[model samples]
Target: MKLKDSAIRPTAIAVQSPASTSTGTTAGTADRAADRTRSGVLLAALGVASFSLTFPATAWALEGLGPWSLVSCRMALGGLIAGICLLALRVRAPARRHWPALCAVAGGTCVGFPLLTTLALQTSTTSHAAVVVGLLPLTTAAYSSVRNRTRHSRTFWGAAVVGAAVVIAFAVQQSGGSPTGSDLYLFAALLVCAAGYAEGGQLAREMPGWQVIGWALVLCLPVAAVGAALALPAEPVHLTGHTIAGLLWLSAGSQFVGMWVWYRGMGAIGVARASQLQLAQPLLTLVWSVLLLGEHLTPAAPVAAVAVLVCIGVTQRARG
Candidate 1:
């Protein structure tokens, strides 16, 4: 008796070798995926470390510089560095289609978030700013979900809510039991910063990460330069070593290099998982705040940190 074609097909499929070419290709693809994931996590961690100093450094520099002056100078300097890099590398201008996305990048990091954070730091301690900025990763994740039209599990949303509560509690405890105007500014900064992160990460999928930031900086050059010029003090900058050091770090590390790596990581591992790595940033920022800005951490700070960390971990494990 002869078997039908469907019966024969089933036997043939069932007898397929594990070491077949197709299976080998699948295994190789998975290995590459794993490698990309590991590389992206490391890059994200480095980016986070570079950014950890920002709030502390900005607060320290605000002692000598006006908020507008600090924001303008940082943007101008960052733009110059990015321009020089683009020229030296001979990177072509991004396609005109990318201009809108570049505008989003410039608006968020170069203009909105930096300006708002500088103003906020003029009135807030680095420790308080760190707690407020801790809310950023969740914001980024939320934006990512909306942009991708993906749904995360209820557990993930729950974890985010818990994390937000911890941040609010920490902010209140640090602010002597009430929210302040500075917290409001930092909240605004988070909103803009998250938007930028998501948009830049999306752009990075199609272009080089460095090119994305470099172009964004170049696009904002005129505005940044003009703002810095107008905001310049009539008196010569009597630069203190600490203030100058802070400004340079903000210009070189946080504005340019950190963003380059961050976008690349987001492109590689995706915005959602990459943003999870940022949960470590606020903790690191507090360390920098204590050592650099002489801000003392409150008793509740550690509790908040632990709670946020647990929430982040839970969110990562939850289905999306």
Candidate 2:
């Protein structure tokens, strides 16, 4: 009887094994793939919305606050929120060796980028800033290829040159009248911010995307805070309802939530695909500028948008 039972058990195991194993594996793989796709879509949407409002929010805040003050306050608030999240998640502290890379990204993205965009919006319309920012990917790709010692195709260079020409042409066309000192300051800010973005993207490849940005904001807080404090004495600081709301949106929506979603999307789908999603930002900015600031969408807006779209497509294909 015992020998008969053992033989029966072997046959039963064999009969059940293949069907259950295959079913479980297929279901698990499907679930994971679905999750990744969902996450990617959510992240991309969040990044687009958050980034679109960036210029409008900055423009609103700068109505009362100085550029440095607005930037400093936003960074400080964002850093605080990120710190809480890191603590809640029990994320491990980054290694010492990563400090330089982290600082570079923080200074560039959190401090440098926002600071410049704010200053730019002080004189330029959100539409103008959007146009300038649309060129960010091209700048980043150019920097990456150079830094990585990778030779880009002629097409990549051509697209970059053409896109740059569009930006320059727009600037020149806009510059026919007397440009203010503030406008020059804004252009300087755009250049610096672009450098920050290129540096941040490179670092993001090595470090956890969230942590890289999180730490960068943390590092930049002190610098921003100090600058804000110094600038406060000379500026007429007023905290109006519009300014407060603008600050809240920029800090919470754009810096904190937007960046986390962006980095997460970058992790799930590679940066190249995630970046194409940013193409929506400029057009959205144009819309928002019209609605929020009553600024007209210039005829050049459509042309600039097309140029940015073409550049984004070219860059994405090149990356692939």
Candidate 3:
């Protein structure tokens, strides 16, 4: 009778096994999700660190290269590198439907932000450039929210307003209590970069992250090369080590390599959440300015950076 009972219970044991297996699978999926999110965050932070040096490096590079020459050459270099990467990796072109987004990416990042920011750095101190670039998180968050078709609470908007105000005040302080043309250029760069980031992040969801930027750079290659040719200075550049190093990094690091990580992170983590990580950029940029470019920072600059960071954090956490 005991043996017969054990044989009958085997059916129940089989039935329970499926439930246990299902539970294990669900837990495994959750763990994978958590791990992906963590990796995305770390990548975003790395990209931000790479980007923080851009303004300082540009300012340093500008000492030898004319603003137009610097922009044209760096972009051409970036385009060439990106084109080579695309060919090397055998990446397919984005479908025709994605061409519009790719064009927007090319216009905004490959053209607008780099051109505007380089010009802005010409007239602005690296410290001032850092302060202006601090506006990026707010702009990026706004654009990301729109691109993703999400809603933010009033708390988020309020925080953004306050953060913008703080940055504006800091810019004014840097310019003797009035906005300079450099401020306008930097602000334009911020808006254009936000658009590029949001568009590229969306595109990254469908394609490889690096490929999005790589393709866009390739798309702009001819234009960038022609522009560089047109903008060549009459006098040959007396290239210093700093100038050469800065241009190389700007071309390869900021424009291409950094965006690889950034778009990947944004696609994985969602653009709004990823953009929040940029709050740390201002502080990092300040450090770069002081160390790399020998720029002086006003006491207010640090205070404003902290205030903006806190404001961005609040906006990120605000409930809709």
Best by TM-score: 1
Leading candidate by lDDT: 1
C-alpha RMSD values across all candidates: 6.1, 4.8, 2.9
lDDT of 1 at 277: 70
- For residues 1-320, could you state the per-residue lDDT of candidate 2 as single tens digits? 34676665755343568889999999999999779856865776687788898888888888888877788788888888778777888888778977776776676668777876777677677776676566555565555556656676676566666766676566555555455455655556555655555555555556666776777777766776787678777677789887888999998888867776676665565444555556557778888989987887777778877876786567445533
TM, every model: 0.90, 0.77, 0.89
Candidate 1 lDDT over 41-60, as tens digits, reads: 78877888999989887876
lDDT-wise, the better of 2 and 3 is 3
Query: Which regions of candidate 3 deviate over 4 angstroms?
Result: 1-12, 17-25, 233-236, 315-320
Compose the digit string of candidate 3's lDDT tens values, residues 1-320: 35676676745333568889999999999999889988887888888989988887887788788887888888889989998888888877779989898888888988899899888876778777776777787788888877778987888778877877787677678778777778888888989989998899888889988988888888888887787787775535768989999999999999999989999998888777677777667678888877887777778866877887798678657765
Return the lDDT, model 3, position 316. 55
Pairs with steric clashes in candidate 3 = none
